[model samples]
Target: MKEGWTWRLPCALASALLLAACSGGGARDNPDDSVLHQDIASGRAGAEVTFDGTLRADPQPVGTHEHLTVTTPAGDVLEVDHNTSLAPWVPAHAGDHVIVHGELYIDPGPRAGVHCTHAHTSSGCPRPGWVELGGNYYE
Candidate 1:
């Protein structure tokens, strides 16, 4: 009886640890936003990039897109246009940190941002994209 109890205890503890790790409870690695800066400096557009930032505001639905602003660690503010027509809207709020993977676009004018944040890859969106908030990925 004693040997059985000892083995069960270790097994239970190991299972608990594995469950926490799989549940995304541990610290997540910070995303590199510097690539985005490089893209902007090189006048690059329509490039797929991954970065992290803080939400500047709640998501607003416009046409078929869910638009939101994000402030990067380097203080660069960018507009994130997630297409709701292709995927679900991200449930993010102001001040929430999020990881974004999308295609970057810089207009001829002053505005520059990212779009094509969806899971499906099509002609319009060659590379799949997603937004990570609180361990959940919304594409």
Candidate 2:
């Protein structure tokens, strides 16, 4: 009985360790981890550029504020906020590919986008400073 218990203890511990490693140890619990808050804190607002990266969406707060953290290809992070219609793309899951086009707002807060919207569409969303998207068609 003693020998069996001793072997089982180590096996149980080893199984627990393997499970923790495979589970990612709750790393995805905090969705804001991908957003580079340090850069926004250092006064790098109003700097607009095309950023492409994996999309991580926070599940909390429902759809009023669609929070998306983009991990840029160059390793920089940017958070995109869509205050408009959040029904289309809220509660996004991690690992979703996303591309954002908007100016960085500096005043009244950290570097973040205001009035930003998603660029995902069957026909492709419109680029900034060119045309507005999702409206009555005019030719």
Candidate 3:
């Protein structure tokens, strides 16, 4: 009887630890601002380009980054990604103008273009992307 109780105690502690680790934050729990309406790149996934556009929608949480859709003055649409891990995320809404410098990557659809917006603190990562929103700059 004492042996069985000892095993159950360890098992219960392990289960609690596992649940806490697995229940970390995610999009559904920490969703970004709702978009008022819907919706980067000119090339393959590692090409660097600098462009400007007007924010088409509010920021949305994607994977480990914030997703934004922007429209250039030339009427071209660009999908932008700002890594949540890189810098403190500042919320923005539609019609905000921003300038971005980043590596462009091709994705399946839905304007999924650019990424790699993380500063290279170590070697062997793609070049970081920079975003100038309002008057603040983020990399």
Candidate 4:
């Protein structure tokens, strides 16, 4: 009887392990790689990243910054804040596709964003970022 129970214990353990694998092996430490909700992980403040997205709206003025909303190819919606002096000079519009390289910040509602597209006089700022559109680059 004890020998039969020993086999049952091993079978139960194997079932649990199989179930864990089927359920994604529990939660990941970071889920930025998932296309459905990648922004939450990838948008850690101060990290540099480059991605392609379609402009969802015209640049809006947010105080001294120029803000643009975009939809990533992976279906993530992100906002961009341009604080460089050239913010007003960089033209963008809805439906335009753009390639962007920048430091990402997590913002409420909008979630991910890029800012500090130019050199910062202070230390500990994110590296300069850039936006490339239609053969032109703006930083």
Candidate 5:
């Protein structure tokens, strides 16, 4: 019985290590915004994306979310829906450059945008999201 327990101990440790690695944390090493651009072009939604854009307008209150319209350097306009309930409002204005990380959601007209931009505390948000403006990070 002692010998069997010893053998199983190593297996248990190995399984825990693998599980820790698979559990998501931090952002991927996407150096450029090309992947995000591709996601937009392909009309893919529900993907975690990060990119920089120029604020096209001031943030507006839409329910619990602070809505922002930003234009990517590549000429694509993206809506950034930061959940004010989960995070603080970004003190940004039109023409301010900003960095955004969130889950993408595509829809017709002005409904398409990114959401879930907040800190992740559980499985509901697989990847943590945040907004960076004027050197301040909001999660």
Candidate 6:
């Protein structure tokens, strides 16, 4: 009986080690490498781009920050930081399509924001003063 228990303990330890090895590390440990590895490898890091996608509004705030999800035409999803004041402007509907223009801060994670100086868009892309964040626009 003692031998059986000892053998089982070794098996359990080995199983745990194997599981740990397979799991590896998490995103928190290497945020930059985890987030921008593909972009860096592809050499498309600094390209100014416009992505068209339907918006997905989060049910709850993300990390104490207002979050907006843009599902690109190619089906790629981008999580954006709408900042503070812009939160009120976010569209309530999840399916609204929008074209966001801003520098893609890819390293830490893909995030874009239109500053308070940018003009609001009643329809189409933002024009020039204080643009809203997630509001639905007809275009």
Which of the numbered candidates is closest to the native, going by highest lDDT? Answer: 1
Cα lDDT over the full model 3: 0.63
Instruction: Tell me the spans in candidate 6 whose CA falls farther than 4 Å from its real position.
Output: 1-47, 57-64, 86-88, 108-139
Relative to the unseen true structure, what is the Cα RMSD of model 1?
A: 6.3
Tens digits of lDDT, candidate 5, 1-139: 6768988998999998888788644334332478877888888888888888899989999998899998887877888988888899999999998888888888976345888788854365677788888777888
Better structure of 5 and 6 per lDDT: 5
Q: Candidate 3 has which clashing residue pairs, if any?
A: 40-79, 45-105
CA displacement after TM-score superposition, residue 97 of candidate 3 (Å)? 0.2
Q: In candidate 5, what residue range of length 10 has the lowest lDDT sum?
A: 23-32
On residues 50-122, what C-alpha lDDT tens digit does candidate 4 reach at each position?
Answer: 7777899888877777887878767777787777554434698999887676667787764677766544423
Q: In order, how many clashes per candidate? A: 0, 0, 2, 0, 0, 5
Candidate 4 regions with alpha-carbon error over 4 angstroms: 1-39, 86-88, 119-124
Model 3 regions more than 4 Å off = 1-44, 110-112, 121-124
Off by over 4 Å in 2: 1-44, 57-63, 106-115, 118-139
35: Cα error in model 3, Å: 29
Give per-residue CA lDDT, model 1, range 1-139, as digits (tens): 6758978998999999999989688444456788888887787899778889999989888999988899999777889999998888899899999998889999777577998889887788888788899989888
- The window of 10 residues in a row where model 3 has the poorest summed lDDT is 27-36
TM-score winner, 1 or 5: 1
Top TM-score model = 1
Ranking 2 against 3 by TM-score, winner: 3
Candidate 4 has a TM-score of 0.63
The clash number for model 5 is 0
Note the Cα lDDT for every prediction shown: 0.86, 0.47, 0.63, 0.67, 0.81, 0.45
Judged by TM-score relative to the true structure, which candidate is superior, 5 or 6? 5
